[model samples]
Target: MGVFTKFGVRLLLALVLLCSCSIGYESDIDYSLMPVKQGDKWGYINAKGEYIINPQFDGANVFTDNGLARVWVGDKCGFINKKCEYVIAPQYSSATDFFEGKAWTVKPKGAPVLIDTKGRSCFTLKNVRTVYNYSGGLAVVVDDNEMFRAINTAGETVFELSGPAFVTNFVDGLAAVQNMDRLFGYVDKNGKAVINSQFYGADFFLNGKAIVRADDMYGVVNKEGKYVINPQFAEMQQDYNKFLIKIGEQYGWCDERGKIIINPQFENAFPFFGANLAAIKMGEQWGYVNKEGKITVNPQFQFALPFIGKVAWVKSADKWGLIDEDGKFVVNPQFNDVLCSYRLFIPVRNYVVSEYFDVEGIISWINMMLDGNKVDGMTVTQTTISGFRKKYNLGEKGVSVEKKYSRDMSYEIYANGTFYENVSDGWWGTTTKQLPNARLDYVTIQLKLKDNENTRPLYDAVINALGGNNGKRGSGQYVKVKASPGIVTIYVSDKQIKDILNDNLGWSNY
Candidate 1:
């Protein structure tokens, strides 16, 4: 997904608040000097929740690294430092966080302007209808024409476009934008349309993919504007990457291509987390499924959640216990309430097991190593032989290898070996070699390429010639590269991903 498409959603939710004082704990709480409310006044507290600055101000904001915090005196706002002395006396009606040595402030009787630490106006815009403080060296400014444009810190226009468009700060090369038609899309920093405003709604790109909504339906799409999962789902869980989808009243699982990996037979479903297994509900019972949609644990619990490490929280007779993937109890059902906290579960009594944290730390350390060198300095080369027996000159029967090349990562297109129609009727685990110091995660996808016209025969022949050792042959497809450890799926044509998969590279076309 592109950045702008996701920004459109946030921009819509921020319009009214931008015109007024920002609300909510994240906007107001100064974590450095935690703001606490007492009756009608606000005070600053330390991490221990003890008052550091007595309740006096009507409102307060987090302290900046420069040692100044925003405080509301009656109806006006000003900057106060830790010594309880006014850095900038309360005079402005509205103010924002300081960035790059300046902050945006709006006077009681004047428009907003960039102010220096000394509370003096440093710069102002002539016809600024709405403006955001500089971020990533650029701020979004709306002009009198209702058009949005990106302006540098010096107030020079970087790019301008005709609107009624809502623009968001660019991150990771793109920002979400909405055009006059009220559709969402993405734009690059140069203000060029990378993805046209078309979707009804969208989200920021993560792991090279994004969730998009169209015609009141949800689905996942790739950066190239192709629907990896078609827009047929009614709802998606918080973790759409796991492909937990809602269809009508039932929930199920799908692959990146929108194919139903698991039938919509569950009453409810939750997205997969650290492990591929997901908590699913059927009637009053809960269980889990691997990514292939096969039941790893039967529907036997009163409630269950996705596995965090090797264990998950499962409820039986209203009591929660920790169970491993094999459905054996690590912690018997005894807790009143047990919720997931990464690798540990928080019991009802305000305590956690120290043993769980030790395991979590080890997992975290291993993950750090895998992320650094998992794919570093790796190479995959596919060799093509003309045919079987011709090279051997023994008149034996076998398919010939055609051509070979080092696999390229820049392109999403490739060739793959296929399965025989009968041999395709099973599920398999897809795992990569354990990188040094890192644990490998696996996801299961259905083996369906044998039904496709372009891949079936070629893959069938390749598998047969290789004597059915998919792992050995597939190793030639992907050389590892350094990146964050965890799967980032990219969907290509059936032929392309299959080619990658035939060589045992972990990719999904579903």
Candidate 2:
């Protein structure tokens, strides 16, 4: 099973799992059905924004080349076909996207295993600390002994590195490895060091060359370890046949032989995208520049992204929108954020900056409760069960309120929302002592966790909004209650209610 830390939980969570392979593996992507958010629920939509699947799943991912997408049901994850039918039931505690007809999955309290699209276990991986996505017919794994090795789809160890060496996933038939000397080099799939560990830094091969750092400068090296471009630039990156090089404080473009194609002048720039136009920053705004260094698009937007096909996503006035190659607004700036997958722009509202969780709206609602203010036209401490029912008309809205009696003559009201939705579950309670006109003393909201990543930003944002990690307040303190492995709950009350909702749930200041 994977271990969890305060901030390091699910460190292996990745947004994109497929990589380029040279071993004739299928790598085509399906862009017909893209994941979109509709009022806390996730569903699939076409490029024209028509719902192909209704908003129901707790979470949704893009359909892979194999015509299957991963969807979440409550806490367990499963795979679904393009028709929104389950090909694999929601059972795995953790799972990865299918690549080349195979995926890696971990069941509850079980070791990791490789499964095919039909959900049949190909083989089990024992004592593996970490497993990366497969590339070039092999996947990299870190063993319990902290050693790196590569395993094929059949679960056989193809090669294992000796000594204290760190390696990366294969790309372009080569993987970068760092030797005991702390220097980087290239190694083939057969565990042979093709290039000596002599550079301060090295990157995976792209096209036929790679960017390497030596003598505190960047250059390009070919497969034969020969310098195609000598080390001289401060930094370098490859884009197609062009190279984006930075010198001192300016960015420009260079050719395969280190010839200056565009003079280094822009403050910041991205690699060339569609139509050979690159986004470059000037002053405090961003625009587009052609290969000839001509300003094609005027600098005006607060932020801009590379053109994917015919349009690109840009930010203005803190809102994201889509723009055509001519810099005209193709879509108005109304969404809180936008995500791009396979050249499709997906608009999302109330989005958090983290890739894993989207709970900005949930946090904002919780903050209102903590402030003892009105939330959704209802105040936490002053709202009674009867008043709440009257205000929202739960029956009319088709929302069922579950009632439970406690041993202390107190009753609790439990309500469940859409699975993995903004507010997954909610709780309200009152004791007989305050009966007839009883008011709520506490309110709790739970948010579902689909997967995990570097949650430091989300954690820090919540802490800052709730008066820091100490959970200080004027009338009451906020507590972060740990629920199941895939759930997080926030509690706001006039006084501590940890004992009332006791399931031995751990609590900590926000």
Highest TM-score model number? 2
Candidate 2 residues lying further than 4 Å off, grouped into runs, are 1-27, 54-58, 73-75, 163-166, 273-275, 341-510
Could you give candidate 1's per-residue lDDT for residues 85-203 as a string of tens digits? 89899987777766556777777535567777778887776555567665557777765445678888777899996546644455445666778887877777788888888888766
Tell me the TM-score of model 1.
Answer: 0.43
The number of clashing residue pairs in model 2 is 0
* C-alpha TM-score for every candidate: 0.43, 0.59
Question: Which residue pairs in candidate 2 collide?
Answer: none
Q: What value does the lDDT take at residue 301 in candidate 2? A: 92
Which lDDT value does model 1 have at 296? 87
Q: Looking at model 2, report the run of 10 residues with the lowest lDDT sum.
A: 345-354
Q: List model 2 lDDT by residue over 211-317, tens digit each.
A: 88897798999998999999999877665677878898888989889999999888877666324577788888999988899998999998876654555567799
lDDT of each: 0.52, 0.62
The C-alpha stretches of model 1 lying farther than 4 A from their native spots are 1-30, 64-67, 99-101, 116-120, 205-209, 232-510
Backbone clashes for every candidate come to 19, 0
The TM-score that candidate 2 achieves is: 0.59
lDDT of candidate 2? 0.62
